[model samples]
Target chain A: MTRFALTLEFDGAPYMGLQRQPHGPSIQQHVEEAVHAITGEQVTLHAAGRTDAGVHALAMRAHVDIEKAIDPFRLMEALNAKLRPEPIAVLGCAIVPDDWHARFSCLGRSYIYRITNRRAPLTLERGKAWQVSAPLDAAAMHHAAQHLVGHHDFTTFRSVHCQAASAVKTLDRLDVVRDGDGIDIHAAARSFLHHQVRSMVGCLVLVGRGKWSGEDLKAALEAKDREALGFNAPPDGLYFAGAVYP
Target chain B: MTRFALTLEFDGAPYMGLQRQPHGPSIQQHVEEAVHAITGEQVTLHAAGRTDAGVHALAMRAHVDIEKAIDPFRLMEALNAKLRPEPIAVLGCAIVPDDWHARFSCLGRSYIYRITNRRAPLTLERGKAWQVSAPLDAAAMHHAAQHLVGHHDFTTFRSVHCQAASAVKTLDRLDVVRDGDGIDIHAAARSFLHHQVRSMVGCLVLVGRGKWSGEDLKAALEAKDREALGFNAPPDGLYFAGAVYP
Candidate 1:
């Protein structure tokens, strides 16, 4: 069997997220079904990351094995055509080594959380961004975000249902900046626990609103308790930007 | 009666257009209905521009007359509350003189069109931007756009359905710039003939793709013939950004 790596982009508004669930429709089920229709082979797609519902992806990587030899371009075109009516697109396709797994071979992951810091409700960016009517101090949020960087036990920012064995993870970067009328929080790490990025953003939002300070974040990290953290940011603002390979 | 000016924004994917149409739902009908639902007053809203179907608005200006006194903030909040589920928002509201009309009193109007130039189909900006796989020379497009600026008879760019009395109009600004993977076209004028902006963008796209030159645009303008112009750009990329009043 030949392994094919596909890069994809999708609007996560309508699905139950990246993984296939018996409860509802998913990005994986639709893509796999499309691939099966094209190749006449039942294939399982292994994605680099499983994003939550309402969380978009710009360049999500996935690996699938097929028995037939197929041209990458044709495969991409056929998959896209079959996945029609669904807000998903196969951006790029390439042949990879049979042993190269999409999730295991990944070295890093990145995400972007968008927040529209304006008094007005979003029209154009309705489902795409988090709308905060109160003005957010991005600079303050950036300062507070710095404390959360580097290797640390992120229990305060991890979901209760996270399957990771330990809360300790290395954070390579956490950047908060203003773009137009919105504030973007860009995070990068080797890997992350469930809802980590959203949890951190929720705390940073408090900092932006002057309700919390850098010291408060530092204390939360030290406490290593979920109760110490602030609210969880809505899923609308989150995006699975991409995964990095070594 | 008190006259209130409102700055509005909407995603025009669901509505027919800015003006009330007998066939399909329009932004005007939605706003008017929301206003009546909130205040129990049947009021008509006059906008600075009547955008076509699937044409979004970033900062559309409108004026409404209320027979009874009302707080601008409360009225705006009530209208927004009632307009839920529809992608429309009242960005700002203010009390204005009876003489201040939404359309006639406008001094300047600005618009922006976004084009995603990439090989892949857009996921995030599917309806919000025009996606073209071909690589576009934005610098060349910018150079060509300069030729269309200044007072001139824009008959070639004007639509046959345009109701403007005169074809001659002053174009204050027309700029094409590249932003990341997208191209942004910004235009400003005292007023514009119907389809003028879209027509200009269509011609500019050709220029950017090396199919035409700046001299060709000049020739088209000088010809003052509809046949001289290129295709009209899709309404999805066009936005009524804002209206300026003196």
Candidate 2:
């Protein structure tokens, strides 16, 4: 069997999530059905990260094994053709070593959250970004985000149902910058717990709006209690930017 | 009566065109309806440019005369609230002079055409950009676009149904630039004929695709005949960027 790595881009408005579920459609189900139609082989597809509902991806990485002898370009073209009408595009495809894994062998992951800071309703950027009617201080948010870097117990930031065994993880980078009328929050880590990025972003927004100061944010982080969290951002603004491997 | 100038932003996918059409909905009709709903006055709306169907707008300029004693901010807020579920927004509103006109008083007009030059189909940018699968040489396109600049007979670049009195008009700027995987063509002039921008862009794409050369483009412009036109680009990629008034 040849393992083919695929780089995917999709609009998450239609799918339930990245992983397949019995409730509704997903990115996995669409891609798997396209592969089965092309190769007539029932195979499972594994992704570097399982994104939540209404979450987009710019370059989500995935690997699928197929016994059929097909060219990488042709496989990609066929899969893209079959995934039509749906907002999914295979940006690239290549053959990988047998031991190369998409999930376990990943060295790093990155995500970007978009927030449109304006009172005017979004027209061109609707559904693609989170619209915050209130003004945001990007510099202050950046200053507060630095405190969340490094190893710490992120219990206050993670979801109550998160399946990760440990509450402690090292955050390599967390940056907040203003782009045009919007703000971008970039997060990078080896791995992340469920809702960690959104939870942190929600609190950072409160700080930016002057509802909470940097000291208050630090105190909340030290509390390590879910009830101490300020807010939980919606999944609309988050994007799985890309995955890195060594 | 107070004449209010409004800066509008809209996704043009839902309307037939910017003008009040006899058969279908339009941007002008929607804005007029919103004004009537807010002020109880059936006012006529005039725009700086009447964009074609499926064309978007970033900062389209329009004017409406209202007899109601309402502030600019309140009018903008009310119009925005009524324009919801229609993908249209009033970005800004200001009271202009009684003689100020949205169409005739405009000194300069600018437009941007976005072309996604890539092999894969667009996902997030679907219906928002024109996707050209073939490779495009932006430098070559830019070089050829210079031939269409300056004063000349644009009959070959306008629709046959164009109603302008004279075919002679001066083009101040015509620049082609590459932005990531997309190419942007910016055109500015005191005014333009019907289908002028789309016609110019279609011929430029041919030059980019190597089907025509810079010399061929110059010859086409000199022909001054509508039959000399190569093609007319789709309305999907066109945007009424903005207008300037003296």
Candidate 3:
């Protein structure tokens, strides 16, 4: 059996989440069904991250083991052809070692949250970005984001439904920058608890709106309690950007 | 009567065109109906340009005469509320002079064509961008684009059904720039014959792919015949970016 690594890009507006659910469809279910149609094998697909519903992904890594004697290029083309009508694409596919795991072997992950700061309602950017009518101070938000960029208990930012064993995780970076009419918040870490990025971004937006201060963010981290969370941004603007490995 | 200028942004994937057509819906029809619903008066909406079917607009300038006394903000808010679920928005609204015309008074117009050069199919940008699987040399396209700048009888570029009295028009600018994985072509002119920008971009893509040379583009312009055109790009990638006025 040969293991293949696949790079994926998708608009997550229609799915319940990346993983399959009994209630609704998912990226994994569609991919697996496509694979079954092509190879006639019921196989399991593993992904680096299981993104929430309405959360987009620029490049999400995954892997699957196949016994068929098929080339990577043909496999990618066939999968893309079958996945048609669905907002998912296999950007790349390649052979990988059997030991390489899509999730367990990942070194780090990164995400970007998009906020369109404009009074006008979003037409072209509908469902793709979060719109805030009030003026936002991106510089101030950047200052507040720095407080969360280190090893700490992020319980205040994590969701109550998070299945992670511990809240302590090292955040590699957190950056905020304004581009034209929108603000982009980039976050990187080895791993994240559920809703961590959105929660942090929510509070940062408050700082940008002059509703919270940098000190408030630092204090929230110290509290390490879910009740200390200020705000939780929606999943519409969040994108699972990338995952890295050696 | 008061002439009100409305700045519109829309995703043109669903509409037949910006102007009303006999067979399908249009941006004009939607706006006119919405206006009538709010003011209880039959009105006509005039635009800076009549974009083709499937052509998007970022900030399309239009004008409508209304007898009802209403503030720009309130009118804008009401229109937005009535146009709900549709991918259209009123970015701005203000009162204009009685003599001002959306088309005749416009001194210049600008458009942008987007090409996503990649092998993978688009996900988030499915209908919004033209997917070109081959590699494109944006610099080569830009160099070929310069040959179309300046005054010329662009009969080769104009649509066969064009109703303009004269085929002669001055093109102020044509620029090609690559942004990440996609390429953008920006065109500006005092006026344009039907399908001018799309025709030019289609030939530029050929030049970018090494199928045509700069000399070929010049020859096509000199031929001054509709049959001399090499290609005509689809309206999916085209956008009515802006309109300039005195």
Candidate 4:
């Protein structure tokens, strides 16, 4: 059997998310079905990260093993051709060692949250960005986010549905930038607790709106209580940007 | 009657185009219907330009006369609220003099065409960008486009349906720039014939693909015949970017 690594880009509006869902359609289900059509094998697809509903992926990495002898380029072309009418695109394919697990071998992950900071209703960016009509001070958001860029107990910033054992994790980066009427928050970490990035972004926006301060963010971090969470940003603005490996 | 000028942004995938069509929905039709619902008046909406089907607009300028005494901010907010779920936004609204027309008062117009150069099919950019899978040399396309940046009889570039009295129009700018897997073609002029920008972009793509050269483009321009045109890029990649006023 030969293992193949696949890079995918998908719009999450139509699917449940990146991982498989028994209750609804997901990116993985469609991709695996396309693979089954091409190779006639019911192989499992492993992904680097699992995105929630309405969260997009720019370059999500996945892996699958096949017994059929197929060129990577031809496999990619066939998968793309078969995944038509769906929003998923197989960007790349490459042969990998059997032990190169897409999930376990990943060292780090990054996500970017997009916010459209404008009073006007979103047109071109609808469903792709979070439209915040209230004026936000991005500088304040950046300053407050600095408190989150280190090792800390982030119980307050995690989702109730998170399956991670420990809330204590190290955050590598959390940077907020403003461009025109848009605000982008880039977050990187070894691994994030479910909803950690969205929870952090929500509080940062509160600080940007002057509803909270940097001291408040730090206090919430120290509290380690879920009830102390300020807010949870919607999944619509989140995107799985990339995965890093050793 | 107070004339209110509106700066609009829209995703043109839903409507026929920006103008009111006899058989189809349009940006003007929806905006006018919203105004009638609010003020009970049959007011006409004048736009800076007419876009073909599926051509988006970033900030197309337009004007409508409203007899109801309403603040610009309120008007903008109400219009946005009324045009809900239509992928149209009123970015700005201001009172303009009666003599200032959205179409005639414009000194220049600018457009941007987006091309995604990649092997993968588009997902997030479906109906929004033209996808070219073949290798494209943007520098070669830029060099060929420079030949179009002056006063000339552009019958070869103009559409058969173009109603301009004269085919001679000075093109102020035609620039091609590549960013990652995307190519953007920027065009500016006082006025352009129907399909002029798309025709120019199609020939530029041919030049980028080595199917044509700068000399061929110059010869096409000199031919000044509609049959001399190479191709016309689809409306999906074209955007009515902005309008210049003096």
Candidate 5:
């Protein structure tokens, strides 16, 4: 048996999410079906992170084991060929050790939320970014984002349905930057509870729009209660940028 | 009557072009319809450039005369509200002098063509860019493009169906830049013949791929015949980025 690590890029508009679901299609199902058609063996695929519906991925890492002998290039090309008409691409494939698990072995994960801070309704970037008509103070957003950085109980930022046992997690970085007319919020951590990034971004936007101050954001974090959550941003602007493994 | 100079943005996938057409929908038609629905008076929209099908625009300049007494902000807001579900936006609207025109009075126009230089098929940027599997030498393309700059009778680059009265036009700038996995071709000029930018880009790609040398590009330009044209790029990557006026 050979284990392969695949780097993926997908537009999450049409799929329910990254994980398999009975109600609708997912990235995993399409990839699994493509693998089955190629290897003639039903093999399960494991991913580092499970993104929500309408969330995009730039370099998602996944792993699969197959008994059928195939080269990495051939597997990648064949899988990409079969996954056509769907907004998914196999960016790279590499053979890996059998013990390397995609999810369990991941050391860090990162996400970026894009906001088009402009008055005009987005045309080319309609679904790709969150549109905020009010002019944003990115420097203020950046300053406020610092309040959420470092170790803390992020209960106020997590989803109510999150299954994680503990809300305590170490946030390595939270940065807000302005690129042209767009504001990008980048978040990094060893692991995150469900909807953490989106929830944090929602609050930061309020701060950028002068609704909340930096101290207010820190107070919300210290509250550690879900009721204190200002808002949960939509999944359209969230992107699983990449993962790191030791 | 108030003459409004509107800064427009649109995704050109669903339209025949920027101008009104008898068969299919156009950007002008949508703007006109939106105005008619709001004011109950038919009006004409004049654009700085008549872009082709599938050619997007970032900040297209246009002018419209409305007989209805209305404010610029309200007119813009109402037009945007009425142009719903379509990938179009009125970025800005301002009252302009009656002598000002969208097309005839324009001092300069700028365009950008995007190419994804990679083997992987585009997922997030499927319709937003042209995908070229082969590697491109941007420096070589830039060197070759320099030969086509300045004043010249660009008959070779003009389309057979081009309606411009004269072939002599000055190309102010043609820059080729590489941004990570993408290549951007920026073109600026006072005016251009139909399909001029695409034709030049097609030949520059040949040079980048080592199919043609810098001398060959110059020779093609000097030939001044449409038969000498190497190719015409697709409209997918073309964008009417903006316009300049004095």
Candidate 6:
């Protein structure tokens, strides 16, 4: 069997999540079904990250094994063409060794959260960005983000349903900056638990709005309690930017 | 009656045009209806530019007469509050002289046209940008755009339904540049004939694709014939960026 790595871009508004569920559609099921239709082989697709519902992906990496020998570009084109009427596209494709796995071989993952901090309501970017009518202190938000840069038990920022065995992880970077009328939060880590990014962004947003202090954030992290965290930000502003492979 | 100058921003997808139309909803109708609902005044709103359907406005200027005595900021807030559920917003408000007119008192009008030149189809920005799956030479497009910068009879680019009395108009500026994966066409003039911006962009796109030369554009302008133009680009990419007043 030959391993193929595929880069994907999709609008995550219509799917339940990356995992297959009995109630709604999933990105993995559509991609696997498309591959099966083209190659007549049942392929299990593995992704670097599983984004929540209503999120988006600019470049998502996945690996699948197939028994047939096919051109990478042709396979990408065929799969993209078959996934028509759906808001998904195969941007790039390449062949790799059979041992290269999409999830286990990943080095890091990156995410970006977009927030429009404007007094007026969003029109063109209504469902695509988190809107905050009150003005935000971006400089304060940036200053507070530096406190969460190192490795720690991030139980306060993890989902209640997270299935990770350990609560401790290394955070490579966490940056917050203002761009035009919006604030962008860039986060990177070796890996993340469920709802980690959203939960952290929620607390930072509170800090931006003067509802929470940097001291409060520190205490919450030290508490190691999920109930001590702030509200989870909506999935609209979250994006699975990309993943790195060694 | 006091003359009020208002700054507006809107998504032009649901309107027929900026002006009042017999068949469908117009931006004027929405603004006027919202104003009447707020102050019980049936006033007509005049704009610096009359943008077409599917076009957007980042910052548009307008003027209206109000019989009620109201502060500019309060008027703006009340009008925006009453215009709930609409895709229009009053960004700013100012008091102008009685002689000030929205259309006639404008000094210059600026427009921007966006094109996403990429192989993959757009998902997030589908209706907000023009998607072209071919590579474009932005330098060639810029070189050709200079030919139409000075004063000339722009009949070749004007629509058959143009209502302007004279086709002779001076173009203050016309610039083409590439930003990341997109091409931006910026144009400024005292005024423009109907479909002038879209038609110019269409011809420039051909030049960017190496289908036409710079001299071909000059010849088309000199001919002053409608049939000499290439085509009218779609209205989706057009935006009334802003207006500069003296």
Runs in model 3 lying further than 4 Å from the true structure = none
Q: Rate the local accuracy (lDDT) of all candidates.
A: 0.92, 0.93, 0.93, 0.94, 0.94, 0.89
Rank all candidate structures by their TM-score, best first, as comma-separated numbers. 4, 5, 2, 3, 1, 6
Per-prediction interface RMSD in Å:
1.5, 0.7, 0.9, 0.6, 0.8, 2.0
TM-score of every candidate relative to the true structure: 0.95, 0.98, 0.97, 0.99, 0.98, 0.94
Off by over 4 Å in 1: none
Docking class of 1: medium
Tens-digit per-residue lDDT, B133-237, candidate 5 = 889999999989999999999999999999999999999999999999899999999999999999999999999999999999999999999999999988999
TM-score: model 2 vs. ground truth? 0.98
Ranking of all predicted structures according to lDDT, beginning with the best and ending with the worst: 4, 5, 2, 3, 1, 6
What is the model-wide C-alpha lDDT for candidate 3? 0.93
Please tell me which model should have the higher TM-score, number 1 or number 5: 5
Which residue pairs come into collision in candidate 6? none
Candidate 4, residues A22-133, lDDT tens digits: the string is 8899999999999999999999999999999899999999999999999999999999999998999999899999999889999999999999999999988888999999
Candidate 2 structure lDDT? 0.93
lDDT of 1 by residue, B161-210 (tens): 99999999999999999987789999999999999999999999999889
Q: Residue A21: error of model 2 in Å?
A: 1.2
Candidate 1 lDDT by residue in tens digits, A148-239: 89999999999988999999999989999998788999999989999999999999999999899889989998999999989999989899
Error (Å) of candidate 1 at residue A58 is 1.2
lDDT of 2 by residue, A33-100 (tens): 99999999998889999899999999999999999999999999999899998999998999999899
| True-structure Cα RMSD, model 2 | 1.2
Best by DockQ: 4
Clashes of 5: 0
What's the lDDT of the predicted structure labeled candidate 6? 0.89
Off by over 4 Å in 4: none
